[model samples]
Target: MNDRSNARKEQRKKRYQRQMARQQKGSKRYQRTRLNVARIQRYRANCIKNMAHQVSHHLVADSTTMVVALEDLSLKNMTASAKGTVDQPGKQVRQKAGLNRSILQSGWGQLRQYLLYKTFQRGKLLVFVPPHNTSQECSRCGTIDKASRRHQSGFACTACGFTDNADRNAARVIARHAAYGLIRNKQPGQELSTVTLRPIPY
Candidate 1:
């Protein structure tokens, strides 16, 4: 969808520029081109929203799922632009901008919002555990090391020599954390205003 959107955006940009140069600012042709661009953007937004709804509904409605655990991610902070002020210009501005666009395009915030309300309405527990070291930690041996996930999709534990998909390992870790009641108390309607977790028995 992003690729298609970018292609369409480029094509529309050229046409819009040409129309503005030749036709008047408030001319019919210029207005028409602007409307077309807005329509395409709206369509993309609807598609992303629908996709998030479907995925969130599935997780909440699944009979086998009593608790759903996810990494506590701040989408806004994760996708912030790296363009600094003129006094101190930022580096990798182009790459950061591209990454920010991709993150926003993926609708992570929308998905989380859907999951939040749906899970609450369905009477299911939704927990967000700390996301740090989830991908690097080995699910089998509980070892934490950066080398465990050397590839994007692969994971291999250096301690136990266990191999699995990186995403799957992270999911397992999240589930285990939830099972152990390792989650911050931040959900709505909760009386506690502080972070709470079960103490691990040594």
Candidate 2:
């Protein structure tokens, strides 16, 4: 999927540069190329929107699911430009730019918006939990040890020797937080309590 998208993006860029170089502004050829560019952009956007709708619909349509929990992700902060002023240049600027592109292309904000509206329309609860330390926290033992996250996809609890997929463990942590009402009535950006959370039984 990413490869296809990247190829299409490259094609579009080349087409746009050719149009700019070979066609005069306001001419018929220029207008035609402009419309083609716009069409490609609109098609990509619609594809993303349709995928988001399908995913959100499936989640909301689950019969046993009454509540949906999501991380309150701040995309703006997550994708902020890493380039700094001349006085203090930022490190890993190229890597950060690549990550930012991936994040933006993933359409996370669009998916979240679709989920929000669909949940509301279905009369279900949609809760957003703080995203801090979720991947490092163990869902089985409720241990918050950073060393447990030894790999990108694997998570092993240092305290209880529990092992699970990193993403799944993070999701379980979010579920426990929502189930325990740890952040009820709390404003956005408010810190969760430091009290030890009980392990949720699967």
Name model 2 segments beyond 4 Å from true.
Answer: 1-6, 9-11, 14-24, 27-29, 81-89, 182-202
Q: Write the per-residue lDDT of candidate 2 for residues 127-165, one digit (tens) a residue.
A: 777888987999998999999998978999999999998
1-202, model 1: which lDDT tens digit per residue? Answer: 4677667775776676676678777878878877876776787788779878887887777766766776777876665546656886678777778767766776778877888898799876678777788889888878999999898789999889999988788888767776555334346665542322221110
Global fold similarity of model 2 (TM-score) = 0.74
The top-ranked prediction according to lDDT is 2
Worst 10 residues of 1 by lDDT: 193-202
What's the TM-score of every candidate structure?
A: 0.73, 0.74
Clashing pairs in 1: none
TM accuracy, model 1: 0.73
lDDT of 1 at 47: 74
